[model samples]
Target: MEIILEKTTKPFFKKHAGSQALAKERIGAILEREQATGLTKVKLALRQPVAGRPCFELRCNLAKLGSVRVAFILDGQVARI
Candidate 1:
């Protein structure tokens, strides 16, 4: 699976110093769990559709930044964030 961070999301990383790394870690864990089990069996994230498009939200909490919601649409083997 490939993860593509949308262009609009770049600013968030720029504004928050460590958010990008944390997000990556969370995403990696999600993928690992999903691979070991399955998307349906993977927990720790929320599955919510946006504009009728299936989307998943991964929440990351940083000591300095609080919580950030990383929402991505899973299309086949690609994940658009």
Candidate 2:
């Protein structure tokens, strides 16, 4: 699976993450883990479809940043964050 960050994700990180780089790194780590294990470690909740593809909310907790939640839609082998 591939992770693709959406445009709004930058502002989201600016507001909720202490370090945007770290947050992105975390997302990359999640991607790596998922690709390796074929399992999602972060909290994922199924949501309504967007453009006919199923959506999901991925929740991550940053040590000093509290919980950061991002909604994404899956299209083929890519996840649009």
Candidate 3:
């Protein structure tokens, strides 16, 4: 299984530097364990749920993200759907 992450806003990081570091540490651990193969190994990996689950739902204007690459609009450097 692949885990998808939504890019966080810059303002948020600016406000929570210490918390962000801790989060990165925990995330790194999860990604390391998740790299193992097989159901048993996968099941044994450390599991941590997002504090605010489904932090962001990428939705394109009008409807869902379209087939074309243009579906994603770049806001300066940040990409938006």
List the RMSD of every prediction in angstroms. Answer: 4.5, 3.5, 16.4
What overall lDDT goes with each candidate model?
Answer: 0.65, 0.65, 0.31
lDDT of 3 by residue, 55-75 (tens): 122221212222111112223
In model 3, which runs have C-alpha deviations exceeding 4 angstroms?
1-9, 15-17, 38-81
**In candidate 1, what are the lDDT values of residues 1-81, reduced to their tens digit?**
677788978898898866676776666566556655666542334455655667666554555677667667766666777
TM-score of each: 0.54, 0.56, 0.30
- Model 3 per-residue lDDT at 4: 28
Per-residue lDDT, model 3, residue 26, is: 44
Index of the highest-TM-score prediction: 2
lDDT score, candidate 1: 0.65
lDDT for model 2 comes to 0.65
Clashing pairs in 3: none
Tell me which of candidates 1 and 3 scores higher on TM-score. Answer: 1
